[model samples]
Target: MRINVLQHTPNEGPGMIEDWANAHGHPMVTYHPYQFGHLPNADETDMLVILGGPMSPNDAQPWIKQERTLIQTLRSRAVPMFGACFGAQQISKTLGYEVTKAPAKEVGWAPVYRQSTVIPGIPAELTVLHWHEEMFEVPTAAQLLFASERVTNQGFVLDHRIVGLQFHLEPRANNVREMVVNDYPYIQGSQLNQTAADILTMPVLAANQRALFHILDYITADN
Candidate 1:
């Protein structure tokens, strides 16, 4: 499969998703729109993966608008998609849902309860990384998959092919360290924030990685 990745920033790359693709021998291409302003054509993309970023989906930027349009086109083509954090919000917004400010900011490790078992091997509850202040509503056609205490729409699955996750399940230890170094300001002065030292010490990395790979396998499995 030819997987096309949309990376918004240099720091927020595909993390373990890249690992999975490489291990499975799937050819992957990435576009750094933040620097190059280029997007891939849908005809050449068998699957799409949009990584997270600091920007909101509602931002009045040319690249953001073009990304949304590309998302819509991919959806219409029934191309499998997986979105994380800001990427999830972009999917929600493209489906005519609102990506608004979350009632509270969620940063660091948090528990997300699985609301539906549409995807096999996902447990009822799991701890994952949260680093966004914005939340998106589930689209009408999607089934709610997970929810956290602070965020009701933590994840959703559309047509059993497209998945959106608000949390960072793909972040490995080094990824988290880079995020901490680059986006440290987001952790300051927030009541729900966790220190860099504490976040790095969390023992949930293995569990998160397992869940991420399970979801990826489930989504890309050939029926």
Candidate 2:
């Protein structure tokens, strides 16, 4: 399967999603829209994976709009899609929902509560890394699947083919380090934010990788 990843920044790549694809013998390609300002043809893409970014989905940048257009086209074709953080907001915004500033910025390891058992393998509560200040509202017709104490809209599953998450489950230690180093200034002051040391030193949780693989498998499953 051809898994196309729409990446917004250099620091935020596919990470373990690439690992999953490799393990499953699927080819994964990543597009840096922010830099190249180009996207792949929807007809050529089998599955769409949108990675997180520092920019808001509501931005007026041409690349952002182009990305949204691609998402719409893919959704129309019923292609499986998985989004993370800013990518989640993009999906929600394209679905006519709002992406607004969260009640509070969740910038570190946090726990999300599962609201529905529609997607199995994810525990009732799982601690995942977070670095987003904006949150997406659950789209109409989409099932709200996860939530956290501070963020009511942590995740949602739509049509059993698309999944959007507000947190980081695919980032490995190196990915986390890159993000933390590149955006160090953004992690200051918030009580929800974790220090660089804690974020980097935190042991990698096997559960996060398992949950991420489950999500990818569920979304891309042939139904």
Computed on alpha carbons, the lDDT of every model, listed in order, comes to 0.88, 0.90
* Model 2 TM-score, 2 decimals: 0.97
lDDT, model 1, position 131: 89
What pairs collide in candidate 1?
none
Q: Could you list the CA RMSD of all candidates, in the order they appear?
A: 1.3, 1.0
lDDT of 1 by residue, 161-211 (tens): 789999889987888888888988787754466887777788655777778
Evaluated against the true structure, the overall lDDT of model 1 is 0.88
Query: Who wins the TM-score comparison?
Result: 2
Off by over 4 Å in 1: none
Clashes in predicted model 2: 0
For candidate 1, the per-residue lDDT at 52 reads 94
TM-score of each: 0.96, 0.97
**Residue-pair clashes per candidate:** 0, 0
Q: Estimate, for each residue in 1-223, the C-alpha lDDT of model 2 and write its tens digit.
A: 8999999888998999999999999988888889888999888899999999889987899989888889999898889999999999999999989999998888888788999898878898888898888899999899998899998999999998899999989999899999989988888865575788888888669998999999989988883
